[model samples]
Target: MENGSDIDLLVARRLQALRTRSGMTLNALAERTGLSAPYLSRLEKGERQPSVGTLLQLARVYGVSVGELVEGRPGGDYHLLRAADATAHQGRDGRYTVLSGPRAAVSVMRVELPPGSRSEEARHAGEEWLHVLSGRAGFVLDGEPVVLEEGDAVHFDSGRPHSLANEGDGTVTVLIVSTAAPTPASHPMPPASREATPVTAARRPAARDR
Candidate 1:
């Protein structure tokens, strides 16, 4: 049974190996993944822990799944994923923990939105389904608001611009299943029309439907 530290080490090694195999330098990877070169270097050298969101970006560039990045291989059955071993990532978005296996076609994530926190608005390919495990959740899809209580769930096209937030004084926990199409890397990242991540770390004001 691997612990959190062990998982982090494994992922670091995998990141280095994958980047090396792809013949990309840290700078090249930074451009491709929209992460800073220094941060990428730290992640490669085990000086920093990677967020699931960052891993997802890297996976997209490499055309692999997050499970592949974490487990370092493609095929396996009967994976015992312990919560202690799972890595949780914090960002301006929510805390995201990827709970699916490498070969799984979909990503299962446990997302926690702090009372004063919310996920960054996202527009992407594929589909999204989420069930509220605890607390209350507020969702805005393409500017329309939807609220969910415990045991509530919703499925929608992920292509619609959307975001989620905690709607109460307590934290909101949701199980999210998402499917993304991988776009393989052929060269350095193209210029982004806009920044993918927010520059200010301050939590955004949670906007609920009036």
Candidate 2:
């Protein structure tokens, strides 16, 4: 069995490599990930193990799977992530923990939202499914308000603008799964005023959806 310290060292080295490749400073990454510079510094030094939420944020930012970041390879089909080894992030309202392998067809996360708190709306490429684990969750999809209680779930296209919030006077926990699609490419064509045909929605999965 791998010890926590060894795992932390592996992740530390990989995190540094990814940051260098992306040309992102510690401060820059901290700002983007909502982590403190000091905390990030300690992580890079192999003094801490990042939370599942932190790993998800980093994977989203770097376009790599958590497996790749932590294992130095696209993990083979079978891999196990123990709860003790899972990465995590705690905020004033709640916490987030990633449960799926990085860069998989589907990414999974456990999210906690505090009462009266809402998440930042993200419009990107892919499809998302969310299951409310506990409490009341308020979802706004393309300007339509949808409320979900415990045991309820919702699925939607990622292109539509969406955000989630906690509706009840308590914390809400949800399991969120995102399936990625490739973004359509833009091409410039020669001027032809003839009636243009509307392009059909194309589906391709890529890493930029987060």
Q: Please list the C-alpha lDDT of all candidates, in the order they appear.
A: 0.69, 0.65
Tell me the lDDT of model 2 at 201.
22
Question: What does candidate 2's lDDT look like per residue over 113-138, in tens digits?
Answer: 87788876654445678888898788
Worst 10 residues of 1 by lDDT: 195-204
What is the per-residue lDDT of model 1 for residues 12-120, given as tens digits with 9 covering 90 to 100?
A: 8888998999898888887776678999988887788665456656776776776777666456775668877776755345666768877535667787888977676
Instruction: State candidate 1's TM-score.
Output: 0.65
Taking all chains together, each candidate's TM-score versus the true structure is 0.65, 0.58
Error of 1 at 191 (Å): 11
Error of 1 at 41 (Å): 3.2
Model 1, residue 87: displacement in angstroms?
Answer: 7.0
Model 1 CA RMSD to the hidden true structure, in angstroms:
7.0
